[model samples]
Target: MSETTEKDLYAVLGASPSDPVQELRRRYQQLALQYHPDRLGNECSSEAESGVKKFLEVDAAWRLLSDQSTRRQYDLQRRARELKQDWPVDSTVCLDDMTWDEDDCVYTHSCRCGGRFSITEEELEEETQRKQEDVGEKEKEEEQHREAVVCCDTCSLSVYVIKDVKS
Candidate 1:
């Protein structure tokens, strides 16, 4: 793949985003050994050159993910990209603009087409649980503040709900 193409770093190291640091390190080492240029020594073929390029990419991914700060930044960027890809580009109402419905326990925002975009409390809670399960306690704490994307019930529009922090 071209360098400009968006690559999932976790995929490069053959690990999941939820994988522990040790597991990530292990996988990186395994991939490095398999793709290292020296490992394919005395070869001047295209395959050998490809292996070296892959090794470099794998090493770069590991370097970013192995560090807690860089990983957090990467996660934020990745999430933003995913949100853009998953939701309607032009329809992004902020949580502050939504009306909170006490009965339904959801934040609702009106779409231009008259459809309402809503996100229920249960949905936010479930998302939090999933994140906690995937990223572990430490990272979960660091990422306590997050935005949830909710779609309009009638139209293809969407909105972002900034969940209230729970005690």
Candidate 2:
């Protein structure tokens, strides 16, 4: 999920990743008690419904954070996601905007830093294959899409390449 639109489990329980287990448990208990559906009464009021949702979120947060292995995995994945999103994109260029080197089987775009940003046709094909292999049998989704980031050969600048599936 996109970071901006995605919900943060830590924020759900008013806890941080670095917080101690005791602190997390304390925050989780506080939130659980505050949002427990049982305390909201029998009436199907909007507040009660919202409380139920909050309670479920709190419970889920606790489930992931309470386990040592699961917590480590979650932290690693979150860090990778943040690192992926933190990179600065020098520009966004379409695959067609690049010059194709038929001999090298690579597409190249000129960077403002005077370094070349290049991606090979084989690399793109390999990425598509990797994504296809990653699809689960239970997931019947048919759409296939992936991003190809091309970094400058001589500089830290990177270009976001948008490859046209038809191109």
Candidate 3:
């Protein structure tokens, strides 16, 4: 997999997101053993592609969230979400060069070209920041993503170690 969406890894593994590392490891091991290819019958013989795929998915999700480093990152992301939710995202906008029309109770902007625009202050600020980020685009792309072969479609198997996941 080139990228894994920012999912709650613990939830994906069917565990509480705040589960202890040791518990997480134990649960993952149990799931991995249950899903091992050796335990699965021949794919061609059984014709259970979807079944095998689901098993692999459960195994992969468990493996990713069980590890210390990956688990920590997932936890941090979860915390970030909580913090962001608590932040007061004020949506009030400020209008530029517009007198409030009592009839409409909305501010309007008149352009030199005889055009008009209506926007809140927040929208304008957000737009300005987005424009700045675009103008300062990175010169070289960063390969922030790490590849992992989380599943064997032909068989239900997975590896927990980083090296194993990579191959």
Candidate 4:
């Protein structure tokens, strides 16, 4: 739902991240009805096709953002991803130095700036999958090195979450 997200779920629902849950639900309901394929009738028109696509996207976005935990995870990932691209995330650190939060599935390292640098397990898993897809079976014999850049929650400092994955 944040501005940094590649696919802005908020924009899909015509809502913002700051909007209350009730407001989001209301907006979702309105959009659902407006774009419902049934409402568009049985006509095989371009409008109907567009409506169906929008309706599916709206539903998918709501599914991800409706849950409090999922939304938090999404927001965290989006913020970190955007910051990685814009901020000076030149510092590197291994995952062994970070503290793990089991409930949130996040790894955090305390920054000297009185903030925490965090990265989610989901982001790390995705990176692993992407690496697997990019390399051939022969390349899998070698160790995998991955890096996810994350920014401090309280300041502008960023770090590369570098880790080596065994084959």
User: Between 3 and 4, whose lDDT is larger?
Assistant: 4
Error of 1 at 71 (Å): 0.9
Candidate 4 per-residue C-alpha lDDT over 1-167 given as tens digits, one digit per residue, 9 for 90 to 100: 34235787888888988888788899999999999988999989898999999998898888888899988998787665554455587588898778998888889999988899988877966756655665767775564676666779999888878787665
In order, the Cα lDDT scores of the candidates are 0.78, 0.77, 0.50, 0.80
Question: In model 1, which runs have C-alpha deviations exceeding 4 angstroms?
Answer: 1-5, 86-102, 107-117, 120-167
User: What order do candidates take by TM-score, descending?
Assistant: 1, 2, 4, 3
Best-fitting candidate, measured by lDDT?
Answer: 4
- Candidate 3 clashes between residue pairs 3 or more apart in a chain or in different chains: 93-121, 94-121
- Give a tens-digit lDDT track for model 2, residues 79-133: 7566457468878887887999888888998877788998987776665555455
Tens digit per residue, CA lDDT, model 1, 126-157: 76676577678888877745566777788776
In order of appearance, the predictions have TM-scores of 0.57, 0.51, 0.41, 0.50
How do all the candidates rank in terms of lDDT, highest first?
Answer: 4, 1, 2, 3
RMSD of 1: 10.2
lDDT value for model 3? 0.50
> Which residue pairs overlap in candidate 2's backbone?
none
Better model by TM-score, 3 or 4? Answer: 4
Question: How close to the true structure is residue 48 of candidate 2, measured as C-alpha lDDT?
Answer: 89
